[model samples]
Target: MFTTRPGRPPSWRRALVTGGAGFLGSHLCTRLLDAGTEVDCLDDLTTGRPGNVEHLAARPGFRFLHLDITDPCAPDAVTGPYDLVLHLAGPGAPADCRRRPLKSLDAAGLGTRTALGLADRDGARFLLVSSAEACDGRGDDGPPRSPWDDGHGDTADAPDPIGPLHTYAEAARFAEALVTAHAGARASNAGIVRLYPSYGPRMRTDDGRTLSTLIHHALAGAPLTVPGDGSRPLSVCYADDTAEGILLVAASRSVRPVDIGADPEPTVAEVARAVLGLTGSHAPLEFTDAPERRSGGPFDGRPDGRGPDTGFARELYGWVPKVSWREGLARTVTAVSGCPGPAPATTAGHGTGRWLP
Candidate 1:
């Protein structure tokens, strides 16, 4: 297991999260605050919405700053002499990554460099929230799926071409390399936590992410369209679980790559059904032929569905997910359905970042 740095949470024990106002980032902010650590949330509001963090707006220890990670002034704008920097400002979905390839690439690579530079300058620990996309896309193709088995043998009828499409994976790989190089150059303590598909409240219904899209479609009583056979196996993590894992690694000195996700991959159809059940929308099901398959879609870009090994689990900060997929889905359904009104409004002047929604 990786050890915590000596004299950790140093003078500037505050945490600066580059995308602190987004779905996952907001959750991370909550965790840090609950632990009594002051958190500075920086977001450009590109996808980070104010609603995701409305409850946290008034908290004394939480400060939100609207800015882009790619901006040179990001470090100055946040006023960070931070003890830790969690870089979660990259693209959120495959579609967006595909549609805005340049932005995605820049954010994943240059953005990472800037964040790590801030960490190095401030002498703070850095944790990069990476994607499982770096596993090389296109994992043995047979059929396209939502959650295909990562370790199935040939003739399994499941397809996972294990190569990333476009520059998304390349940028991720580049970012990882940058971190490793920077750490080695300065002997800095930096690491990466590669996350798989995760879903929960605060996810934008409008974004093209499958999880949110399915939930939105179900709630709207619209046809729940399965892109393919829906037999593709998928592993999803609850946002809270992902946040916990991130904290575990960020706080620990785990410098190696660690895979964090839920096991026993669920099929795309199952996810659709789950959403329908949760929302009580009884949405009709539909399947469309996905002819233009990306080189490396979700099914083939991640580690096998097998659980992490003991050594890896320990080295990744002894972190394990607490919430199950079913429980998480139920909780999210309730929360969204019970939303008092529209999500919280993005505020300014209090150091809160820009408002996207």
Candidate 2:
């Protein structure tokens, strides 16, 4: 049974999550429930597994509708206009996007448009979850940055329309634009959060994201694999931390971009080492200069410290990440290692398999 945190208790009656059964989306649903919000989960079970939300199926106030944002059906046609719509249903991992670039593009572009249309028609607030990749290749724009980067981190001497390092990055940019345009027109408030590397429970084990790669290796007591020089620094945010930021934007009146990440940037190598430490694994880490894993270039991995530094997050809404990296990782380790059980048989349309922790 999900319980509430200590407080007067926020009572947001109607909330909608686009990718409710995905890694981050599930957590968002949990957080919303804790805040006393009735959540409607919309997912088509494409990348999202039904098991991710099976636990919440019994919640009196929770409703799960199988609908893909990229291609919405009648059920997902907004049964009741939501008070707030948190759209987190795009391709987040690079590999996932690469595997199905078209679907990813559709989700980021058309999916965003659909969500915005729903919000506009319902007169609901919208909060789109963007990525730090939207900032620049370096992960963030930087504390002292150039205003001309267009948040996608302009490559040195690169052309004016900086080509995206990956299709997913481009899709996020498009989605943000879609949301922003809709917000300016209809919604009372809207904002986009450019999240850096976020790690926590519910992430799929097989996903090609860095944290998942490390955790899987550690779990198997195998050598952790490092791609390229392992010099790329990522502004990793804990899942709960990112969720808190998302919640803040959802409840806030301000409509702008917010960079959600942690300080003391950790290199990719450091991330692997941290996961090993958290897992109590003494396995050796094998660093390989895999060309496929190499960062596109200096511009691809640049980190920009923009967003929340402007005090937009705090000034508009009382939002702060309560969990530190170490604490967040510890919790993640526990959740990933200790689980409900093994997942059941999964098929494309069967919807029986649970999502990875």
Candidate models: Cα lDDT each: 0.68, 0.66
Which digits, one per residue and each the tens of the lDDT, describe model 1 over residues 129-204?
8777443223344322223335553334233334446566566777877887888888998988777777777766
Tell me the spans in candidate 2 whose CA falls farther than 4 Å from its real position. Answer: 1-10, 72-77, 136-164, 227-233, 265-270, 289-310, 338-357
Off by over 4 Å in 1: 1-12, 135-164, 288-311, 314-316, 337-357
Candidate whose lDDT is highest: 1
Cα displacement (angstroms), candidate 2, residue 350, comes to 14
lDDT of 2 by residue, 83-151 (tens): 788888865666667667777888888888888777666667778887765443322434423233445
Error of 1 at 9 (Å): 12
TM-score for candidate 2, please give it. Answer: 0.79
